[model samples]
Target: MRRLLPRNSLRSRLLGDLWKPLFCLLLLGAVAVFFLARHIGSSVYDRWLYDSAMTLAEQVRVEDGKAVLDLPKQAVEMFEWDQVDRIFSDVRSRRYGLIFRNSDLPPPPEELQPGQSRIFPHWVKGHAARVVAVAVPNPADPADVLVIQVAETMLKRNTLATDILVLVVPVLVVLALLVGIVVWRAVATGVRAVDQVVERLDSYGPDRLLPVGEITNAPAEVRPLLNAINQLIRRLSDLQDTQRRFIANAAHQLRTPLATLQVQTERALREPDAARHGQALSRVLKAVTRSRHLAHQLLMLARSEQSGEKALQMQEVDLAVLARDELERWIDSALQQHVDIGYDGPESGVEVYGEPVLLRELIGNLVDNAIRYGSVRDDGRRGGAVTLRLQVQPIMLVVEDDGPGIPPSERTLVLERFYRRRGAGGQGCGLGLSIAREIAQRHGARLVITDPPQGMGARVEIRFAR
Candidate 1:
């Protein structure tokens, strides 16, 4: 039902918001002009009425011991003559009740003294009239005075007011129309600018994702939105590049192990002698195990790379216990490599807040990297020592080994995915240190690589904030 209604655009809302108040202001101005015109017209006509009353006062006199008007019937008719109005006159004295009158005009409510005059409005026979009253001294008796009043209907005043309104109203309407057109055009131009911005956005594709160019003529209000959109575009571009690199590297790392496994399996099947057949099978099993371990590490690296807040299941983890358990699991591998590995931490638990599974992965990767790369000598013999050490009070964990230590300049590079040292011996895919670093970051811990305290060995330390 709501969809059936016309949608309001920016232009319509802007015009509506501007026009409603303008229309009311114009209407109020017209009404004020009309009343002002009426008032001015009344003032001009009132002076004429007062002059007519003074002329009547000239004809008043004392005759036969009484106040009388000496105006003849012809003069009386001439005094009352008007083209578009009816006129009324009344002459009265305080000593006498009534002196002379042309029509039945009511006397004024207020008293009038000699040499005084007054003009006021009154209603006459259901029509509006202007009344002017004047007082004059009687010629026969100076003590007594005569009051003469003249009144005329408001026909001329009404005509003048109507003519003024007719002249002014059309001009006001034309001015209002001109203002509306200007406002409408201004609003449309602003909306068109916004439309251009939207069109620019729609032109973008995945491969063509470039930041928007700056528009010199754009409104000030739109600049902040453009800046935010540009920031988002940059972030998306970086993510896209990272994804491309990860896919390429993963494929390259898997190809070598997969090819080895296939070759060993074929060689095992082609062996005729029973003893040689068992030896080929053993190599085949070793290849399969190495490939499986690579695949698992790749999965672990991917899991550690995720940065979503909800993916981490955090709890209080005992670092000492976790290290001891993981060390026990790697005992057989260390023995096979002819390397001595052990844990050196408190017997009791030292708890920290983290995800237990990720923490175990972090510790396992550190141990695995040490055992793989550190179990070698200059003579090509596979024998060395790796130790997992823990401390409290600004908690720290250290994995140290007695082997050729990493170069100071390449310490940072080793933390990158698939970055291996030159001439390093092992079946390592070079993801162990990278996975350890990622998990350490997720747990809000700092991982640093430096020389161990005793002398010639690599020391990797994790410092927890708590």
Candidate 2:
């Protein structure tokens, strides 16, 4: 039902918004003009009525204490000169009333003072009229007398009003149209910058995700929105770069193991001696193990890349408990590799807010990496000690191995996915530190590699903000 409602377009709405108020002003002007025209036409023609009444009064005289008017034929004809109007005149004494008249014109609506002429409006003989009365003093007559009353038809006044209307109405209409046009244009001009911004944004694509050609013409109200969009584009570009790197790294890691497996399988198929066959089989198994570990790391990295808040369990779990459980899984392997791994912490739990499974992976990766790279050199000689310590003073987990420490330059690079040191061994696919760092980040901790206080080897410290 709501979809049926008409949507307002900005241009039309702008023009209409401006026009409504101006149209109301125009209507007010029209009403004022109508009244003005009526008043002006009545005022200009009222003088003619006064003149005719004065002419009749001049011929009036007092005879035997009664007023007599020696009104001539040509003199009376002067009042009747208008071709479109009928005129009537009456002269009466205030004391001795009803001296002379053309018709039974009534007395003025209100009394008149001496030398003052009053105009009244009425209907006469079923026609509209304008009435004027003048009070003039007659010294020769004994009566306190009034001079003349004249009533004229409305034809001349109405014609004058119509003429004024016809002349002025066209000009007013044209002016109103001009004003409306100016208002519409002004409204359009005010929002032109918004239109230009929209057009520039419409033409944009990912390849053009920069400044959008600098919308200098856009309105100040939209500048903040543009800035926010630019920031988002920059973030998206970084994400794209990271994704490309991840894909390339995954492909390169998998390709090496698969190629090794292929060659070993071919060698096993061609071998006939039982001892050589077992050697080929063992090598193939090792390649399969490496490939399987690489695939697991890739899957874990992908899962960790999801929205951390959603993927993480909010319940508090003990970080030190997870470390112990994961350390137990690696102890046998560490002992087999002649690496002495020990855990030092409180006998109980060290509580924290995080997903236990991911934290286990983080601890497992750290321990496994220590065993693989820490103690034994390639010639089977042991020289290093692996220690896992959980400190409570500001809540930190520390994993230290006594081996040749990572060089200062490569410490940072080694944490990136699939980035390995120059002589790094086959025990890792190089994703362990990267995965551990990602989990630490999800748990709002910083993973930093620093020199162990014991002089040699790398210390991977996961520090929690208290």
Candidate 3:
């Protein structure tokens, strides 16, 4: 179920998390203050009641072993007089039932002793009162003791309690307000810092893909997010630089073929002799074919670059079967160039996981490169042999030719786009080996260029991990 009130903002979540415990703390503090005020009010009034009971005790005396009051009626009336509370008093002896009394009050305990006092709440004439009870020894008879109790109505205590609440509650509320303000300012400052980072991102364009610099006064908690954003910007900037260079190189490579095609078309259209026109047309067809192959290779290279984002359409492909089929397809083209082509592996059962179309492209590029470059010798002879060898144990594909082998120093260089060897003898652009290497990598295989073990020729091997 969805939340009734979802906390969507960082500021609100932070404040909510912090203020829950803060609110509880304030509530407890208020409760403590209320009880403290009540205690203070009670303590102040209880002292007055105790003193009154003690004064009444002093006025008592023992006459002929009987406890009596030597106080006058006016004195009693004056002692009990108050503006806010009604006062009540009683004097009694253990030996005698009662000695003197003013009004009905709750009596002290039966086991009362001299010089001890207790204060508590009681009802005086159906009104709430606070009572203080004291006991005194009779002077004439040490065995006899008198108990005295004094109580007053609750008016003065209630007024003191109300005054205490009035004085304290506002101070507590102001303190809570100050704390809330501080918390709100802190949350707002942090949120503003994050908003500033967002604003900086919004201001960026494709031409200005710069990193977000460190923000001043940003909290330490935000440092990791800034670092991640800067890293992403750096990657995007690097990718843009690579794309620009790729476009420039691709355009440069296609220019010669297009110019040749244009010239051949113009010549074919202008020639008067049928034979010369037919020859010009053939050259134009060859130029168009070369241009088409170059464009297809460039598209393949772009696809390889973008294929990282997609899941491979993987299937169990027989490596030996794939190589034999590719070799068969290229044999006619090889014979036309006077280069013998053969396969040296099992007809089937050498299986690996890869996309079939991409695998075919990989093998085609390798075989095409072998036919174009491996058929020519240093002396320009056009008869040589190319072999496709596959190993089932380690799952490898090796394409080797009996021609001038690439030098060790130039092996890695040839894998880079458009990196032809210094004395290379082929009409092929340098994307063949690089595209083969890209496809090999995507299939969890490694492509390496080396010389044949028993002959001096270029040998390219793709080793798939078992």
Candidate 4:
């Protein structure tokens, strides 16, 4: 069942709630003022009534020791000015008797005592009155009593109070509304700086890392966030500049050897004698091949450095299968060189996620590097075979050549780009291990160089992350 409620309810929106409390306070203030004015006016009027009563008492004479009044007409006329009604009574022999009375309404209850006052709504006779009555000793005899009662109709007091409220309430309300509007405008203006900052950020891009312009009227709270963003932009801009310079320098340095090899190949093609031409052409082709391999490796290294971490399309692939396929492709080349190439892995799949092209390049480089470097030995005559192994359970790719192994002291140096070992005779630009290391890093894997288990040759292992 729905419950009944008062006519005035307080539940409302923010502004509505605010205004109600203020309006209530204003209304209470207005009521207080109305009552205060009435009290002061009534006090003045009561003094006048008492004075009239005193004057009438003064006029009393003890003719036969009884009270007789010689009340003046002017004193009665004074009550009419304030619309005040009066009632006069004479007391003799301790009994009350009505003397002269003038009122626009019926008198109050007879139980009313002199010098006592009461205020109530008087709906009878179509009007309300505030009444006061007083009794005093007859001044002429002190044995007779004279009472004076005064009442003012409340209609005039109510009209005056209504007029005051009509004038004051609108003024207060208008003042409150103006205050609210000013506060809202101030708040909006304060937050405008944050909007400008957001607009600047919306237009920003990777290339444009410039600091956002300072907002002139930004709020204190948002300034720190803006400063941090500006600092981040500056740091990224510095890093990008460094990477661009590195790519440029690496490209310039690698192009020189490539051009030299191209010129040598053209010179060798122009030789006249068939035998000499064939030998020179073969040498030129070997140089050209080495140059081409170096150029490709350099390009791959540059891509790895410049592309950040997103260059590879990673997916779950079986490294064991990849090793088998790579070995098949290189088997004919190994046969021509009178070398043995083989792969070893379990039948089950060894799954790993990485860019397939880069992973192929990585494994191919390791095997090619081992074969090329391990083909010649201290005793010469191609000592032993090369083996490509894919260990599935741990996901490791191992390339080992049974040629004279690398010295333990030079293992780390061999992985640096273009750093060929002193006694290692091969037509390589020394980028195989470097390129392999880069591809391994891209896949969150590691390339480690160590002596093979039999201690005959170097073993290169690419270990994938678990």
Candidate of highest TM-score = 3
Model 3 lDDT tens row, 1-466:
1321358878668878877888887778777777787789889889888888888888877678666887877887799889888998888777766788889977688766787888888988899998888988876678888889888898877777778777887887788889888988887777676888889989987587888898988888888988988888887777776677669878998999999999999999999999999999999999988898889888888777655435788999887787887778987889888998888889999889998888888999999998888888888778789888888888899999888888999999999999988777877889999999999999999999988997688999999985
TM-score of each: 0.73, 0.65, 0.77, 0.55
Distance from true position, residue 88, model 4, in Å? 23
Which pairs of residues clash in candidate 2, taking residues 3 or more apart in a chain or in different chains?
A: none
TM-score of 3: 0.77
lDDT of each residue in 1-466, candidate 2, tens digit only: 2311334766677666667887787777777777788788888778878887887788788678667876678877875667898998888877777778888788753467678888888888889999888888765564475669888998878777778777877888899899877876666565665666677768877555444445656567667766776677666666566567668878888999999999999999999999999999999999998899899998788767653424566678877777777788987888777788899997557888887778888898888778777775656576457889999888899999987778889988989888867665546788889999998899899999999997788899999874
- Compared with the true structure, the alpha-carbon lDDT of candidate 2 equals 0.79
Local distance difference test scores for all models = 0.83, 0.79, 0.84, 0.67
* TM-score ranking from best candidate downward: 3, 1, 2, 4
Angstrom error of the Cα, residue 108, model 4: value is: 15
Task: Report the C-alpha lDDT of model 1 over 256-344, residue by residue, as the tens digit.
Answer: 98899889889889999999999999998888888887898888876775542235878998888888988898999999999899888
What lDDT is reached at residue 251 by model 3? 91
| Candidate 3 Cα errors over 4 Å, as ranges | 1-28, 54-60, 68-71, 88-129, 132-148, 308-364, 378-385, 388-397, 438-447, 462-466
Off by over 4 Å in 4: 1-256, 307-312, 379-383
On the 0 to 100 scale, the lDDT of residue 7 in model 4 is 34
